[model samples]
Structures are given as structure tokens and as C-alpha cells.
Target: MNVKMNGFISLVLGIGLLHTASAATHSLKYFYTAVSGDIDYPEFTAVGLVDNGQFMYFDSSTKTAVPKTEWMKREGADYWDSQTQGLIGEHQTFKVNIQTLKDRFNQSKSTGVHVVQRMYGCEWDDDSGATEGFDQYGYDGEDFIAFDLKTTKWIAPAPQAVITKLKWDSNTANNEHRKNYYTQECIDWLKKYMDYGKSTLMRTVRPSVSLFQKTSSSPVTCHATGFYPSDVMVSWQKDGQDHHEDVEYGETLPNDDGTFQKSIHLTMTPEDRKNNKYQCVVQVKGIKDDFIRVLPDQDATNVVPIIGGVVALLLVVVAVVVCVVIWKKRSKKGFVPTSTSDTDSDNSGRAAPQI
Candidate 1:
């Protein structure tokens, strides 16, 4: 069941590693994937993200890296050409890595599809001048091996990766280079890009908060949209106190306009709803005010809903909850997994040593 569950979810979710939110903190990450089999996916692909926003993309088919955001067009063609050349080299390397992994897992002759993926990047806190980095690799929705900075060794959770771990860990110099690249080089690039997109990247937009229910007996949802920077928190409060139990937290998803949207659901009995004073509170990372939405004081048994959503996607919320819990549990067991995706914010972002 786990294998089937992972395979199915991996097809859709890239991998997400939630980070601590701060108004002044920013990130730069790269996600690369190489695939093997008769899949429709690109043989190799790459994406670059800044603060959860994809700024550039490359694929085997395009063979060139292109900016995704208008603000990133501040650079000349030479800048994109340089990025294109770099990804070309990495793409070739990943092609070989994918085949090597197929053989490593004894799936070279199998009809099944396979993928090799890598995510790495750096983060900086402008407010404190603090810096951090992460680099990890995954295969077929499971952890293969990852760099451990504290021990300066490679960790292999699956038996198949032990051999590679031994070989890679033997390269002390390369390990140090990777560490330095992530901590120093990657961060330098991040700051440069942040400066280039300061008007777009550094601005803060507060969310539009909405409290709605499909039906009186159904779960009430607190939805927030049109937010920038992607660090928004939504929670429910009961009788002037914080409420945690029987609540569901949704992912901060990207909107087409470059802003973000998020929702949280509350499940309460009809009796409890009548007895308690409830409100939904929202806070965007850099916003000064907390957006509050008080629940309508109506009988829980009332048939009409307060808000009308022609299309209610409750199943999406369930799927996100289940997938996150599963991968987190697997991560705790020392086996983190990820998907073959073009987007960096997929469900299974590799658990970096959080380095």
C-alpha cells in the first residue's frame, strides 16, 4: 500500500519542505529531475525558485533556461544564456545518474518508470544576516542518499544507496565543496537575484480573508487569497481562546497572478457551534494587522450556508493532509521521499538535514 500510495502521489506532488516563516527571510532553490521509461515527462528538467516563486525553468526539450517572472527579465540575454549552459551540463549529468539509478535499483529491465531528483539551495535572513543551506537527492519517490554536513558524510537510508554513499562519502574534498557551494555561492546568487527583483520580491501584500461554509453541517473554511511572499497563517479561535483540535491546515498554494491562497477548515458539532463564539484569524508574514472573520451566529441546523462556492474542493484538502502526514512519518523513520516534478513546491520536498 505504501509503494502504491507513493507512486500515485509522486506523479502529482513534487515535494515540499515547510520552513520557518519570517518577514525578512528569503530563499533560492533549484529542483532537477531525470526520468527513465516511456513516460511523457522530459528526460531532464530544472527549475529555480526564489521565496517559493519559480523564476526560471529548463527542460531537455527546450535546452535553454528561461525566466518565468517578468521581474527576472531585468537581466540581459547573456545572463539567461549562462544559466542555459549550466543547466545543459547538469542535464547531461542527470541523464547518466538516472540510468545508473535504474541499474542500482535492479530496475534496468523492468517495465516500470523511474525518476532521479535533486533539490538544493540557500536561505538568508536580511534582518539578522544569518544564512543556511540544504542539498538532497531522491529516487522514485524515496530517499536515496543525502549530504550530512554535521558529520560531513553521506547518508543512505535504503540498502541500495549504501554503496553510493560509501563511494561519495570517500570524497572528502567534494563534500566540502558542496557544503561551501550551498552556504556561500548559492547565497550570493540569491542576494543578487533578490536585488534584481526587489520591487516584486520584497513587497508585501495582505490577504483577503473569507469565512465560508458549503452547508450548515459541513466544515467551515477560512480562506485567504491575494497574498504575497507565501508566509500566511490561518487559525480558528473558540470563545476567545485558540483552537487547535479538529482543525485542518491547508497548503499555501500559488495563484496565477503570483500571489498565494490558503485555507483552514474547522469541524465542530452543531451544539458546540451554538455554544461557542468562533472567529477565524489570518496573518501574512509582513502585514501589520491580523485579518479576522467572525462566524455568523446562526443555528447549526440551518440548511443554508453563509457563503456559496459553486465548486467546493473538499477532497483536495483531504489529499493534502493525507500526503503530508504520510511523507512526514516516512521522513521521521529516516526515509524521505520526493517526486519527479518541474515545480519546487511539490508535496515531498526532501527533508534537508534542515542545514
Candidate 2:
């Protein structure tokens, strides 16, 4: 279906652990998250571990990652906003605990290096009407400690230092008591968003199409602009058949107003331009029909202006030749006789011509 369901509505319905060594240098480890929704609906959440304001990793809802590379996991960040920063905590006690752990790893108690940890939590109603919670635990070094948030208090069973510092607090107790209520609220919100998604309530403006010759030697381009939801397909067709070879696709980019634009090009030759049989077809997700644009006929192109220019130039040349010929003939008739004998007149009034 090529459905591009960005998590905006999916969150209304729904929604790991590691340790590190001690003695690591003081590096920034940020446990950041953004969560929205209430008790009755699902809460959409994005949790990540960032280092120095740059992303290191994130929990993928689809278990898939973009740029699909070796160090990157399968993760989708479509629901996250790049401009918005999540909350941060100083974690004074956690820092002290990590320093103690580092000391244990080092035979010599080193005080210069420190290990940092960060954690995030979110809850939402699942599609099956069940309340679910998600947590992310992150650390700066390879030998850091892990924190579990499923229970009311954060727990790290290792290195008595971490356990002692992360004792259960009154706030955590209060959150634990309201957990059920929060889950139900998320479920309610999920229902509302689902209805909104299914309702015929949103505006559906058709995409605008434009064509261009990218360069004198390059392909012909078809651009579709101002579409929504970022799900669209643009392709070229030759004589009613889809043309896949010699086609190039551009990434869909967001507009200031949140709409999207994309372009596709067909490698067209001078002969292909003359045929006038190529078509650009655009299909939007959730829309049943396709928008198509056809190539202009050769006669309707700039060739007409070029031909008219040639004809005008020929007319100017012919006019100049005619004027020059007439001037030469007139000059000959007005020529004066060079010899006195040629101009001498006898009893007749007419002048005699020279040999």
C-alpha cells in the first residue's frame, strides 16, 4: 500500500539494558525523551542516548534504522523532532556512584575520570488495548551500570554504590500508584487519534505538476509539489508503458508549511523530445487517482520561434539584394559621358554615345 503512516496517529494508540566499566573519563551521556498522550489513549514516545548534543543511538520502534549501516541499528526516527530537546538531569548521586565503580575497576584509585549514565521512560496504550511502558538505559563507557525503570524506583543491582544511591523516592512511589491511570489515558488518546486518521476530515489538495528540460543534454524532469504526508510516487511512461531505465529519483523534501515535494527525471534524447509521447504520472498515498502530465509536441516547442527567426532573416537578405541591384541599375543610367566625342551633338539634340 506504500502507506507512509508517520507516528503522529500511531502514538495515540500505543507504545533495554547495559552496563559499563569504571575509571572512564568524564564524557557527556544524555538520556533524553519526548512523550505525549494521556491516560485513556496511547502515548507516543521517542527515547535516545545523545553525546555532546549529537545522536549516538535510539530505540527503534520498527527495529530498523535509516542509512542502514554496520554500526547503526534498524530504527525509525520519523516521530522525533530534531529542533526540540528533551529534558536533562544532573544526577549528582549517580555520578558519585559511577566514580566509585571506576575506582573498583582500577587497582589504583584514579579520581580524574568519571562515568555518566542516563535513562528515559514512557508509557502508552497498545493497539490491543493493553497498557505498555518503554525504557531506555544508556551509559558513557563500555563498563557502565544499567538502570531498570519498570518498577517504581530505578534499580541497578551491581556495585553497591549504584544500588545505594538509586534508592526509591517518594516521587517514584507516587508514579507507581498512578501507573494504571496513566496507561488508560494513553489508550483513550489512541482511540481519538485513530478516529481522526480514519475520518474524512483532513484537507486533500491535489499536487501541482511542472516540467523542465534539466539541461540541453540531460533528461526531462517532472516535479510534483505541495503534497502532504510524504507518501507519493512519480514515474515516467513511454507510450502507455512504464519506463524504468534511465530514470532518476529525488528525495522528498519538506516544505515550510509541512507539505512535501519530489521530482523524477527521464533520460530523453533529441529524438525522444520530437516524439512527444512521454508522460509523467504522480500518485499520492490515500488518493485513489493519479495525476499525469504529457510532453509538449515538437511543433508547440521553441522550434516555432526559431523557424520564424530564420524566415525573417531570409526576407531581410532578399530585401537587401533587391535594393543593391536597383541602385546599380540607376547608377548606370545617370553615368556622365567621359569623352567629349561621346557627349558631342550634331544638328540633332540627342548626345552621341562613345564606343
Candidate 3:
């Protein structure tokens, strides 16, 4: 009976040890929140170590006596190191003590895990080729980091020095003032970063569209008002297709409210007046797309006054022409009788022998 009991006890211990080893190998190594402007640390507990890897502690930050192994294992070092060289350095190593790392994990309890396999030194650019003295760190492609209860190993974040957003504004009365608006190029660059997982969000103010009249004789002019100018794309579309190379765009204006505004002018021609349909599409980064149409009704209304004035002027001109024609006819009849009288009088005098 004693021998049997000993064998059962050994088997149970072996199973327990194997389970612990498995748990430790896949633990979470980091925790963080990407949101800024709040408290520095998370409100929950996290754990990490060189030997056991990294894992999350499910208990709240306020709780004591939480089991470390029971915390979720989300990421390992291998995943983090492969995505970016932002954290790699020749002298970089996991120099932080395990106890210190644990204390940091518990102190800044976050709702998610951010595990990094390696950290490296980097320089900060403040211009002038000068760098801040603080040692910067990033993850090599081999490092793994994550947050929350996610099971997949996460790629380490990119360098913190990247620009996240750009703002543009224009003060010109109507986008009539031609200038190169860098807003689109800026957005394209930001998108590149977003595609690479470097930025979390892109934000900006709405952009404005304006229409101006370029023809002196044409009184049909329209203006687009009340658009915010930050982080927006202004484009002109004619007849449902994009008018790319032919159309000219204006400078992106900055508004006092930290937004952006811009305008464009198309010279109204007989052909344009005839077709009479145009559209301006504004695409704001991270916001819904907006489109404003210049319908036939709107265009007709704008041209109505000009048409009325032209019609009135034409009537006056025709009335003057008619009056001139009538006067010329009457003058011709009156002058013909006078000339006939003179001719008759002269002939009678000649024939009456000097009477």
C-alpha cells in the first residue's frame, strides 16, 4: 500500500511541474495603454521575466496576492523582434532586474500587455544635429509584445519620434489664390506610416471649397462657404469623374479654430453653362466623405440674374435701333418734298421769262 501511494504522489508532482513549465514559457512580458493624456500607468497588474517570458496578471492593480502564472500569456520575444529595427542596438540587453520589472508591472497596472524582447539606444533629433541625452529604446524584429488577453505575439511598436499628424490652413479669400497645398502630400506620408502600423490614428479639421467667377462679362459667380480646413482632401469632379490634370486647386487655408479651408475657381464657359453639373468632394482623414454638388437648378439660379440683365439690355438696344430707323424714314420723306418744291419753283421761274 505504501509503495502505491508513493508512485501516485510522484506522478501528480510531475504533472504539476510540467504544467507550470508550460505556463511560464508563454507568459506576458509587458503591459501598456496607447492612449495619452491620462494616468501614466494602467489600473491592472502585469508580469514578465527573462526565464518565464511575459504574462498578464488578471487581478486589478489594487489587489495583492495575485497568482502570477494564472495571468494570461499573450506574447513571446520572437514575434516582436521581426517587425522593426526600431528597438535594436548593438549594446542593448535586458538589463532590468526581474524584481524591478515585476515591480514596474504591478505598479503601472494596465489593461493590456506590451512585451518586448530586446531594447536599444537611439538618438532624438531636435535639429542642429543635436540629440537629447536620454537613451532611446526600440524593439528589433525578434521582440514580441502585446496587451489585453490577446494570444498572438505582437510586433514591437515603432520609434516614438515619428510625426503622427499634420495640420494645414489657408487664409486666401477664395481658393482663387493658386498655391501648392502640401496637405495631400502630408496625408499620403501619414498613410504610409499607418499602413506600416506606426500610427494609431489620423486627425484633422474639415476643408472648405470655394467657387469664383473668372469671366468679366459673366455675372454668374458662386462661393462655397463654411468649411473647416484641417486634414482634408479637396477635389473637383466634373460629370461624375475626377478632373485630374486639367483643374487647378488652391492653397489649403488654416482657420482660427485650428481647421483648414480652401477654394477653387472655374471659368464658366458656354459649354459649362450648357452642361451645368459639377461637384466638389471633400475627404477628411478619419472622417466620413462629404460631397457638394452644383446642380442644374443651382447653376440656373445663379445665371438667372445675368440672363435677365442681358435680356433687358438687348431690349433697350433694339428699341433704340427701331427709333433711329423711324427717324431716318421720316427725315427722308420731309426732305424729298422740300427738294421737289425748290426744283419746281426754279423751273417755273425760268419758263415765265424772268417774272
Candidate with maximal TM-score? 1
Q: Whole-model lDDT for model 1 versus the true structure?
A: 0.68
- Tens digits of lDDT, candidate 3, 1-355: 0112111111111111111211111111122111111333322222221111211222123332122222211223332232112112111223232123324335335333232221111122213322211101112111122111111112222222121101001212111111111122222322332333222112333444444443443433233333432234566667887655445554333232323344454444566656756666666544566746453433354633333443453344333220000011111112110001112111111010000
The CA lDDT at 233 in model 2 is 79
Angstrom error of the Cα, residue 217, model 2: value is 1.8
For each candidate, give its TM-score against the true structure. Answer: 0.79, 0.36, 0.26
Arrange candidates by lDDT, highest first: which order? 1, 2, 3
Q: Taking the tens digit of each residue's C-alpha lDDT, what string does model 1 give over 106-210?
A: 777876667777767778999998887766677776767776656677777778787777787776766776677667767777898898888999888988887
**Model 3: lowest-lDDT 10 consecutive positions:** 346-355
What is candidate 2's lDDT per residue for 82-163, written digit by digit as tens? Answer: 2122111122234344444444546225423232333322233233343443222222222122223345443343353354
Q: How far is candidate 1 from the true structure (C-alpha RMSD, Å)?
A: 6.6
Worst 10 residues of 2 by lDDT: 322-331
Badly placed stretches (over 4 Å) of model 2 are: 1-201, 302-355
Candidate number achieving the greatest lDDT relative to the actual structure? 1
